[model samples]
Target chain A: MNKPKHKKLTCLGIESTAHTFGSSLVSLDEENQGTIISDSRSVYQPPPGSGIHPREAYQHHSDVCSGVLIESLRKAKMDMDSVDVIAYAGGPGLGPCLRVGAVVARSLAAYYHKPIIAANHAIGHIELACMLTRATNPIVLLVSGGHTAILAFSNGRWRFFGETLDITIGQLLDQFGRAAGYASPSGAIIERCASKSEEYLLLPYTLKGNDPSFSGMLTSAKRLLSSGKNMDDICFSIQETAFSNLCEVTERALAFTEHDEVLLTGGVAANTRLQEMLTEMCRSRGSTFRVIPRQFSGDCGAQIAWVGLLSYLHGMRLDISKSIVRQSWRLDQVDILWRH
Target chain B: METLIRKGAEADIYKVRWNGLLAIKKIRLPKGYRQPSLDAELRKRRTIHEATLISAAKLAGVNSPLLYYLDKSNYSIYMEHFDGPRIKDVLDDPDLGTTKIFEAVGRSIGSLHREDIIHGDLTTSNFILISDGCLGIIDFGLSFRSNRLEDKAVDLHLVKQTLESAHSAVADEMFTDLIDGYRSISGDESTNRIKSVMRQVQRRGRYARSV
Candidate 1:
């Protein structure tokens, strides 16, 4: 979608959500035409049972920040000065990790005299996924290490219909996997094991009204494992319960929002079972199901860069002196406080 | 004329009138140990970062004070002046006896955490009971987006610690209410994360005590 007579705006985006430290340079022209010129990512996977420390993640950011920036720019075939804006994940992240990204972004903004845009990491992922598949007004099921919510895009904002009550789907997967002596952040491994296990063990499934109780299920699974149950069966059972709960929530949210399309985003969106279940749910309802490619599904900077460009197009320029790193910033909080 | 409202380790807050509207100014102090140039750069960056975060949270439908201005060169943030009692103040006063207040605070915190933004220091003091009775989170200078269980757990731990330290008499009750409220917004996964992290926090606490 290349066009002439439109001023091309280039953006450099940085993402530091969880274990991934990512940077991407995207170029958007007039009429919102965009292209991802370069993207680089670094992941820090700690050993099993050893959780990700905020300070350690921050250090990881510090170690990879320069390289990621340099590589993204090189891939984009542009220099730092050519970047029209700098965007970074603002909050719903680790404090130290967010600080590192913010510091780098601010420094770059200062050095280049470019406006800085801060985006909510989750919203960034959602928008990018939606844009990738051209999906609109879909039922969104976001499941990651930190979040599990059924959302719908309406009234110019995402309306949340249902979500987990205790632990995030990804977190539950990781914790259960770790307890079962798997690697750290055991989403992929658990998915693999669950695929192999044939028997389904009965676990606690507490559906409280519209909300699903994951903590109860996790506790039940842990107890079952501790009481000499099959680890493989428990893993498979937990995945099934979590995915089933998510699917039920998504169906309810879809019915409540009265939307047909379902778009899934987040790290755990990569699970084949979740994808299969969601696809089936959508198919049964004659609705559409969309999942962005795995790279974009997880944390990345392209969406941040794109959203930053949208803000710029809307004339929301940052007062260079007024930019700061926020560890807990949210997307809805933007309109209340920020004025152009 | 401006009045000094409050002071913390990192900032001195001032109540000022802007165009006949009330505003709060958070000014960062220069660090002594850091080189002058580095400190100035650091202060300017931090001031902007905090202001940006406040604006971001406001956009996400989270209750936070509006950011009026950021004087990054001077390391100061002027935000919509909120006139309300801090949640901590409300919780500490036995006469208030607002049992439902804890639930409200918990929901607000839970909503924030659900959005993946953890208030690094989730003390009751960080929230203001607005005139509308809605709890507004303040001081996003230490906020961040994280999907890690440990990070989220630490945020809850901070809140738990705050309750134990400042609201001990009703700490257990308040914590339960908060979790209940948090569950209402965050759903079951958040509760599970909290339970897991809380267990870890307790274990760590025990280890610390033994050491």
Candidate 2:
């Protein structure tokens, strides 16, 4: 749909798909360019040596939802009346976590009499990165705790060319880190440890066609750690093998689509080593590579707010009763109404 | 004389002269991104594996490029080149009677499955429509011997995904014809089993819960 002349809209988005409860405000001006007004989030830290418990994560989101929302609006120096739409991450995540965000958004919409939008978490990541990086069409390598897929837009939807057949890259790092007595979500620490060693251990590099399976590699890494292998060397080898598998699949997608740009998004996009490797690969093949800024690379409310604004502008208005969380929603199943 | 033709993710294809014949040479290039030892091992293994699968595919009565030579040390393979359009480029052409072509594809895949061969990559791009109007399969780099029903289902699922994603305009008609052709060779019982398994495979994707 063509934008009405000089039309402007503001959206407030909530994200509680996992451990983080985030809120942000985005404003779209007459030019259809979106500006993030404010972004605030509170992340729940699980007990040491344990993964996130879904119930505890839900409680964390419920406790922090209002505070994060208020902080978002306060930082923007705007109130709820200024927001033209309310949006929340609706699916493809933990059901309990998603419910908290959806409930909050629904409650706000009811109180304020504002229209609501149910945004797909994965699409939020992609659209926000695309807007920030100015990539119109590109092969997307979405890597995170819950996802690892090489995708491209075709036939009005994101189509997966390849993905992890088992555990994701993020899970691989987190589980390995936990095996070494670190808490979950230990990608940063793993990266730090990996950088200190140059040794490479040969682990199973499983690539069934374009799809990569990391479960076997994770088991092997744990075995190495138990057998008294140096943690740093194992970390180094895991990163080397896993990142290479990712890049190889991405390269294959690039060859098939011949897209001039490649966009890296999601939580694991924060890894500098991955960014470097992807950049080098793209350079060798004459394609532009862009990573979402480090701060915005991970789960954030800004992505939800930005995509929410797009959905609003495209005339998507979900009734509060009909607006519910879909825990099993897939990215490719979402329609791209805002994009051609 | 040799001239480069296509640079694939795992290998580079070249149009070359082999013993006064027009042939193709596929060389698995060393990836700079992977560790040197890992890269060397992967390239060598895939080069040999592709050669083996290609010969096996022909023995199973599948139409594939004829092998001329295998250069193990160089991670290269020399084979007869059949110049034609990729099936991806022409599957939807209304004038081509595309249903029969898709049926042929299914028949070929059914035969491969019967021989316990799983073509890990089954995209339309890997199929070539040769001069004699016969369907030719290429790229056996990911092919493997598998008797598992899951493996066979995955092969079928990949073809469905490719058609839906890259050739949506005529996917419905094409897929129906493909299943019919496949059933003619595989019989109704195994086809039904494979179809059910393929449904499970589709649902097993991340965030794709079974309903």
Among these predicted structures, which one has the highest DockQ?
2
Report, in order, each candidate's fnat. 0.00, 0.46
Q: Assess each model's interface with DockQ, reporting 2 decimals per model.
A: 0.01, 0.63
Q: How much is the lDDT of residue A286 in candidate 1? A: 72
Q: Show pairs that collide, candidate 2.
A: none
- Please identify model 2 stretches exceeding 4 Å from their true place: A1-6, B92-97
- TM-score to native of every candidate shown: 0.60, 0.97
What DockQ does predicted model 1 obtain? 0.01
| lDDT string, candidate 2, A98-215, tens digits | 9999989998999999999999999999999998888888899999999998888888888788878778999999888888989879999999999999999999999877678999
Write one digit per residue (lDDT tens) for candidate 1, span A131-250. Answer: 678776677788788677666543345534444656778778888887888776898888888787968775665543244668888888889989998777777788776776677667
lDDT (tens digit, per residue) of candidate 2 on B177-205: 88987898899999999999988888878
Predicted structure with the largest TM-score when compared to the true one: 2
Residue A278 error for model 1, in Å?
0.6
Chain A TM-score by candidate, in order:
0.93, 0.98
